[model samples]
Target: MTTIMSSALGFASNRRRRAILALLVVEALSLAVISALHLSGVIHGGTRPYNPEAAGIAEAVIGVVLIAGAVAVLSSPKHGRAAAQAATGFAIAGFIVGLTFTIIGGQPVDVAYHAIVLPLLILTLVLSLPKPRDLGVGRDQGPVSKSQ
Candidate 1:
């Protein structure tokens, strides 16, 4: 019974991790699009409502982080876990900074978007952190047996 429950939980965790990876990929693409739009001057609003410079920086940084995070989550037994953790930390920090900026001088729409997107991004980062054994590789115990 306990083994069955453990297996179920393991399966759920892997599913959640994969979902998080998918979310990160989507976010990376979204950021890339936003960055491209900003660069092309196609999605312009105004200085207070939409600062292209700041938006470009945010988009580029978030896109890079999300892509790196997805790659880390997909790979295993390497610097992937550490990279995911770093991406989580970066997302948290970016959320705080964005919130602060919103409170200071951002418009309502911009502030609302930041408030919503930042938390969701943080959630994805949190969900991406999986344990080593959950990856279903092996333990660092004794050598493998040659049994039938």
Candidate 2:
């Protein structure tokens, strides 16, 4: 069981995976922390009432997706790539949702934090994504070599 857990988590050792993990972690943490702050009255007042519990639930799903994507990429690149893509989408969506909240008169701190966090998420997602060349789909191949 210990070995199995290690195997599942082994991908995080790779530098690329680690970078992605950092971004996901920070995004999740920001939501969780801000939610706590909202509940605690450190941040209050918005068009939409701050719902920390709801935010926590969303963060939990994002966290699961993040961990699963990282682990899946290790065992199967095909599935892992898809998972990573989905994870990237989720990250970006979360950032956009943060912006939407601000637009709707949410807390100023939410916008300020999103300003800092969104760039990190974007950078990591950009790095994790497959380049067209990686899929043998970029640039001119010059000539196709025929083994036949």
Candidate 3:
């Protein structure tokens, strides 16, 4: 019975980890598209002047970071949880910053989109913070633990 329970828990944890990884991938892709759209003038916002080159550069940087973060989370046996949580937190912060700036600049549509993204990012962030023990995985006291 104990073995069965442990196996079940491990499976659940793996699923959760995969879910977080998927979220990161989605977020990265979205950022890439957004940057492309802004650069291509498909999405217009007065708050942030559109600069295709700059947007592309920014998108590339964000993509690299997000991908790296996702890889870190997916690969680390013990610190995966923390890596995912930190990635989520970073995403939340980015959304908040973008939203706040857009609102201050009086871009209604941009603000609305940011508001939506912010909540979703927060939700993912919360999910990422769950302890490994909570998922029936062994306790990990790494320096990068998101619970800290």
**Each candidate's TM vs. the true structure?**
0.63, 0.63, 0.67
In order, candidate lDDTs are 0.64, 0.60, 0.61
Q: How far in Å is the alpha carbon of 133 misplaced in model 1? A: 11
Q: State the lDDT of candidate 2 residue by residue for 1-148, as single tens digits.
A: 1211122223223565556656655666665676666656666666764444455455456656666666666556435545666786786786687577665676667778778877876786776665544444434665445762
Tens-digit lDDT string for candidate 3 (19-109): 7788788878877876676667776646444333454455556666677768876777366666666677666666665655566653455
Instruction: Identify the superior model by TM-score, candidate 1 or candidate 3.
Output: 3
- Best-fitting candidate, measured by lDDT? 1
lDDT of 1 at 77: 26
Estimate the lDDT of model 1: 0.64
Name model 2 segments beyond 4 Å from true: 1-14, 39-41, 49-64, 71-78, 138-148
User: Candidate 1 clashing pairs?
Assistant: none
- Prediction-by-prediction clash tally: 0, 0, 0
Residue 73 error, candidate 2, Å: 4.5
Residue pairs in collision within model 3:
none
What C-alpha root-mean-square deviation, in Å, does candidate 1 show against the real structure?
8.9
Error of 2 at 79 (Å): 3.3
